[model samples]
Target: MRRLGPSDYRDMPWKNGGGVTRELLKLPHPSEPARFLARLSIASVAASGPFSVFPGIERTLLVLEGAGMALTLGGAPEVVLDRRSPPFVFPGEAETSCRLLEGPVRDFNLMVDRALVEASLEVVHLAPGGTRTVPGTGSVLLHGVEGRASLSGTPLAGEETLWLEAPGPLVLRSDEGARVIVIHLTRRESSSSGT
Candidate 1:
């Protein structure tokens, strides 16, 4: 397991050069640094505009702060997302744009090379003195979103993340109420044949 804090994150300009994003973790393709197999980041949207396009990648996004925003994917009708909304998944190749519902917003994003793996994301809420067990098969990421928590026995502060590379069970506990984002990534059987 690896622990990553704010200092470990790197800020970079968006692919479209419209904004900036703090990249929390990224697994780049073996031969291509610009191409990633999996990536997680937080974007600060300061103005309403278009989203960078990433062909062959699948993306999941959720509002992490501020009021919310509306997304228009391709020709589909706008979809509204707020802090309470569940993570939304869409094709990275889609022509996407956003209009802030109210001022600026910060959003968490997860993107993966769909041909190589499948990904799932969810949020878990823990009340004071609560504990939860999460399946730890494949690649799992636990990110502390609110309050303090612990993975197994290691303390995790807000905005910190734990990356589990092996298969097992993970125990999360919090003495105070907290919220955590969980992400699971599974490699495709066909892609693993030669690795």
Candidate 2:
């Protein structure tokens, strides 16, 4: 198991050089975005415009700060997302753009090669004293979005995150109001584990 502290994250330019992204964690430590199998990052979106598309890749975006923005996705209705909103996106869809609803907002982004993985993401808001299982085999990233929380018997403060690498079952609980974002990464084929 591995833990990614805030200081461990590194910043880099977007694939299209439109903005900047802080990479929190990634597999095989890709030097470039196209070479990555799975990645977790964050960015501060202050300008309104379109985002570069990544074919055969799945992505999720979580607003972390500010009033958030509105999105118009291809074949989907307009949606508004703020700090409390869930992730929303259509990986390969075209015509997706953002219009700031309020002001600049910080966001958490996760992307994975569709051919390499089938992942799931969920946000669990646990009130003081509750437990949730963190599975083994697959990858898991826990982010404390609000209040204080404890995971795998360790405490996690707000803005703190923990990344586990194929670790065994784990537990997350809290003694105060806490919002935890959980990311699950499952390999598409067991034979490709070495990749």
Best by lDDT: 1
* Model 2 agreement with the true structure over 1-195: per-residue lDDT tens digits: 566667888988766555678888877523344467887888878777777776777888888888988888776787889977878746844667888888788888888877777878788888788777877668878877788888777888776778777888888898877888899888778427645
Q: Per-prediction TM-score, please?
A: 0.96, 0.84
lDDT tens readout by residue for model 1, 95-157 = 999999999999999999998889999999999999999898899998889999988898988
Candidate 2 — number of clashing residue pairs? 0
The candidate that wins on TM-score is: 1
**TM-score, structure 1 vs. true:** 0.96
Angstrom error of the Cα, residue 89, model 1: value is: 0.3
Give the Å error, residue 122, model 2.
1.0
Cα lDDT listed for each candidate = 0.92, 0.78
